[model samples]
Target: MSIPAIDLMTTLRSGHSTSPRLTWYGPDSERVELSGRVLDNWVAKTSNLLQDELDAEPGMRLGLALPAHWKSVIWALAAWQLGMETVLDGGDADYLVTDRPDSSGRHDAVIAVALPALAMRWPGELPAGSIDYASEVRSHGDVFMAHTDPSASVCAIRAHDGQQHLHEGLLTGFAAPHEDGVRLLVAAADGLEAALSNSLGAWSSGGSVLLAHPDVELTDKLLAAERIHGK
Candidate 1:
């Protein structure tokens, strides 16, 4: 019962550890690039945070209320790696991760995420029971060790429309298609599901992804500068 997400992350770490796996462009001239190893580190730390601090485990629904951003991507991967289901619609979750902490009172635990790359902590006061992700994630281990492994048949993603995607079918059935070794550009306007699907397609095919913010114009110069091969 091999987990596709875990196997994919392992492949990424072992294959091209130094090359940029995810590049992001946002407003205010924000450009962030993460190599395979760095991306794994972020995912590992996040998984550790969920498992050790929050007691996240298999079959739990982790709601992601955030938009299509790098941090959101990391959170999704972390949830999958920990055998938790990612609820994209952000409803009926055991733990909810959101930027708007005030609206997440129903969940058992809430995590406030700051989207900025340089943010060391949540900019404003969080709700009384919420955790600040930016401040707390750094203290966790860079490597993660799961206490329990999820079967391949375990549900992975709960889509916005309530469709469930299992771990075994995540890459082959759910992900978008991409060329081998392609440098694909994914737009934020395409939504988080598209971004995740495209990224999985790219990474699984030994390619990379460039995720552009909705506000960041996709210009000819930018496309050429990034050496993008496909959308």
Candidate 2:
């Protein structure tokens, strides 16, 4: 008998508690993956911490200002859980945007990005939402879902790259192609950011952010996000 490959996302959706929750954290010389409810407790404790922290942070946009580590991944996901926008800029602080054209010949979609790599040249010129960070980053997750207009069904999962061999989450905005297969492509930058933001914030355990040299190749992880989305 053989243990077939599993789709973490699909498994998650099937009321199966077996989808593993793993997190990645490290410095230049070392890295580790931590799991179980300690990580869970940490996330719950920190979700409130972020809420309290953002009480003072003006502008709804909050940046995870720390080396890539367990806390970093937790905080990013926790913020999203609270209904905040968590931006993952590959290098600089800017998140990738999907620049696809609309039905018309003209391009119409646009999203705010805060790429630290962009090198803001002005005073307080860093990108921001119309509100303070708490406002922009924190929201009632349930209400957010209730208010959202129904759109295509989306799958969400984690440890996507390992089993799926998905590169960074640059893959398609995944949809179930059957019970066992998934569809994907390089998602538009904004699309990728929004999808990851949703999953990072909403996942049972917040998503992971593997910190590396700003120029490290994350294309695989981006595509991997889609593969994981098969759930």
Predicted model with the maximum TM-score: 1
Task: Kindly list the per-residue Cα lDDT of model 2 for residues 95-127, writing each as its tens digit.
Answer: 112111112212111122222322232224323
Once fitted onto the true fold, the runs of candidate 2 whose alpha carbons sit more than 4 angstroms away are 1-20, 23-31, 56-59, 66-68, 88-231
Tens digits of lDDT, candidate 1, 26-116: 8899999999999999999999999999999988999998889999999999998888888887568899998888853698899999998
Which regions of candidate 1 fall more than 4 Å away from where they truly are?
none
The lDDT values for all models are: 0.89, 0.31
Structure candidate 1, residue pairs in collision: none
**How much lDDT does candidate 1 score?**
0.89
